[model samples]
Target: MDVIVIETPQLGDRSYLVHDGVVALVIDPQRDTDRVEAAALEAGVTITHVAETHLHNDYVTGGYDLAQAHGAEYLVNAADPVSFEREPVTDGQIVQIGAFRVTVVATPGHTHTHVSYIVSDGTTEAVFSGGSLLYGSVGRTDLVAAIDTVGLTHDQYASVRKLVHEAQHDAALFPTHGFGSFCSSGPATGAGSSTIGEQITTNHALTDADEEHFVATLIANLTAYPSYYAHMAPANMQGPGPADLEVPESLDAAELTRRLADGEWVVDLRNRVAFSSGHLQGAVSFEYGNGSNFTTYLGWVLPWDEKLTLVGTHADVEDAIRDLSRIGIDSPDAAIGTEPRALAPDAPVASYPRVGWAELARDHAAGDVLLDARRTDEFADGHLIGAVNVPLHEILSRMDEIPAGTIWVHCGSGYRAGVAASLLQRAGRDVVHVDASFADVESAGMPMAEKAV
Candidate 1:
């Protein structure tokens, strides 16, 4: 038997496949179908079962179309009393294929209908845990009406116990979401798989903490769900077809400028400090605590729902497009992939940073001005002693205050710094978007000023 996991970084989601001999089952597919279809063909198998762990809030699921093409049956936890065209898999139901016997466990803390599947292939095995369990944490219990406060908290506790208690000793665990996930608990893990004993032994959520403390800690650390979540839930619940897959090309610098000047808001997904120094004049930043942070936020932040002309330091654009497409905003023509075009003075001037951190420090000490592009709270905590603070989102109106020098800019981390560097470099400014740890020169060890108490 073979199990494949597809991680979609764009929308903070993942998909799973369980195969035995020529038969297979896929769970929580991404909007793009090509990735999964290609996986099946390469594995030398025929897909026959599509199972959704739950209604997703991050991106649309392509389970339906995949099931249709392969003449497979699609399954969801029908015990929730919800309606669906495919067969409803209930708690304790076992799905047998070749040497694999997948037993459905009703693990519903994240949602009323959510279930975790334990796949035993008669060997050291794994569980198709969906959102029920993950590395260092668990799923968020806040997805639409399916979430009942007391019920969910209680259910989540029970679910955690069931997964830990009822699971086979040797079964490894896999979840649909992980860190940076809008619906996942976090230590921001990037782990692909772990054993049930591993989670119980190491996962903070499954540790010695009592149920009450567990629930309390979960609620406190949880960030609010993204705006696009509402849309994604229905699309997945209805079993939307596979995403029309495509690898989008990113736009070159000049074309990116043209698109922005024409009204598209560049999203600087990079971390803080780096963003502080400089970025496209009007790019929307996700380095702060406004909840939604992934490229999926592009749907909520983009002006008038215009097609994007994306620019990022990473050469891979497929994840970005997949992230965008998950919330129902797919466009193969969205980006212009890197080939550097020229932008005029009137063009919108967002840029990605090309300078390294060490060089930034040297420029800063050489009398180059350092700027801090972070939220008011982060800037107020501690920044480079002489650096200026201008949050990325407010750059347009505050552009007037920017000093005319060889500016060395920074954000909390480096992503924003890169964007700022890109824009400034394109504008012919001798600006170094500093990706190092910089401060707005408050006292040491402070957070955003206003957010402090």
Candidate 2:
């Protein structure tokens, strides 16, 4: 038996394609199914079944459409009240695909109806633990509802223990969340691969036996997730089709200016340095590159279903569209170019200063405001002594709360601060992008404070 890992780095999730030479079982596929089809074709395997562990919260699912396209069985939890027809799977049920035997296990923590699959071909065994049992932590429990948090926390603790007890110690443990995903309740031990035995010895959910303590810590540590997540489960429940991955309608300088004048979202996908150097006056910065999580931040901050326009190089614009489509933001208008002046010839180009913490320390003044763009929990852990905390996600609604003057902004890293800085610059505030590591705060000799417990 061979298990293929399909990673979605933008959302920090994985989909699995498990096969036994001739047949494959797809699990938790994303909105885009072409990649899955390509993997199946390359492996020379027939897709016999497509299964979903639970209704996903981060992105749309393609399981329904994939199964329909291949004339395969679409498996979903029978307990879930979904809109479409499916081959409903229940706990302790065994499903056979070619030489593989899959046993479904009920592990309801990530959601009320979540399940995991243990596959064995009488010799090799693996567990596909989606959201229930993550690398270092379990999935966050509060996504279901605020009132059900405590109950789900207990369910998560038991679910991890149950999965470990049921699967063989040598069974390869593959989880769908916890690879830099917000779905993870806590930090995932940066392990590329893990086994049931390794997770038994290392994972917090299994190692810590005190249920109440685990519940408290998990609840206290939960932070805000993306605003875009609210629409995902509903869409998934209705059985979404494959994403539309076409290139956006091309816009010239005049059309780009018209969109900006109409107050449509025009995101600049350049690095923070280039963005701060010169950009179209109204465009917000959501840099697309090797390290930047352009999809996550842009999707989180933008209003859901709003008219979004992309301004960047043609390649970058195309990449950004693909990334956005995975998260269900599709068919945005685009203006592609290397320079802002070229993208919008007649529009005035705007500029801002990008600095480091050291410079802020040297130029420390009486009234110059320091803005922290991290989440409230991040701000509480430690922040500049006099900085205002307006997380990037809440920047639009909380604009009035930010004090006027030359505001210097920073985040844990500078990525989020770049987004916040762009928003501030667009709002006509005197802004400076503190584009440096937060680790330099101590070396820069800046005053810092921790929220009093």
Candidate 3:
């Protein structure tokens, strides 16, 4: 009677490895199998089975590999129309892992093929809801159009009601994608695992609500999905697509251009305006989408061997790297902009320009206004004596706020300042970015002003 939840921070996707003495089961594994397998080996347990709640659009599923590696059964939802070497798990079928009983419940909504597994050590039933239900929200129903998503939402509403109202009281709920995922259609914070009843009472989307209302709510917030979905479907339907998912060894702009010409897909993780201005003639973008969340659609739409390169705005390569990785899309070398240090870190900072009170006074004395380009939260703190807050994410939205003149932008640790500089530069603004090195901050003896509120 042992259960473990492993969180992949890069993607905000959670995987579970449930074991009972001699028997073990791996659910919704992330990119790295070593960690899961290592845990099992360390615990002196054998991975008896591997299963996915559904065919994921986010990251590549590792169930087949785990099953192949361990000679265990690879289980998927029978409702999935795609063909695969899967043992169709029957609804309400109980799977054994030593003393633990894992029950299958076909809870389809996010996609037609998705399901949830209820694991109970005799008394407490914990549900592994792949994408059906999350902490304060429900799964997005728009991905799979095979079944009417509205109809599926209705069924999902009923399925959740059944689980919460009658099936298993105190059945702990575990979901794959949690907070900060595009697949999530409702509130996601303070979520790890919860009972069906807790979700029924507390899940805002499900509380005292009916099916029609649920469908409307889900539709309202859903943004224009990444275009990768066009490519991901066929890739998933084919068996064991590709295991060695890594970015290309070399992919400069020229190489990516060639790949696009050869009918391969290129997903630029840049914003809509930047993408619209100029991109690899055919490259589609989800720049606004978090790498992992949007990457699911990226992974689903592209082939394992397809030559793909990322064209993100300045200073998002690390995020781009991890996001694409979790969804099983390897990134290419030579990302946009110079490879800068991580967005923020605990030191004074790294080498670059320093703009302290002296320079601040000079700029302000010369009629220049300080531009604070961190995210809204970062700006909400304190800032320089006088600075205008313009977060990078919302800069494009508030282009009018930025007067047509030279503006200085700075962020904590100075990572986002470069991005703001690049974006503002693109928008034809005169921007001298304060790429402040940690040494510069210390040398200038500038007050450690909090970001603007």
> In lDDT terms, which candidate is top?
2
* Ranking, TM-score, top scorer first: 2, 1, 3
Q: What tens-digit string does per-residue lDDT give for candidate 2 at 324-419?
A: 887889888888786877778888889999999888888757788899999999888888898899999999998999997899999988999999
- Tell me how far the alpha carbon of residue 159 in candidate 3 is from the true structure, in angstroms, after superposition: 2.2
* TM-scores, all models, native as reference: 0.72, 0.98, 0.64
lDDT of each: 0.65, 0.89, 0.63
Question: How much is the lDDT of residue 389 in candidate 2?
Answer: 92
Against the hidden true structure, what lDDT does model 2 obtain? 0.89
Deviation in angstroms for 89 in model 3?
Answer: 1.6
Model 1 global lDDT (CA atoms, 0 to 1): 0.65
**Which model scores highest in TM-score?**
2
Give residue 441's error in model 1 in angstroms: 9.5
State the TM-score for model 2: 0.98
The count of residue-pair clashes in candidate 2 stands at: 0
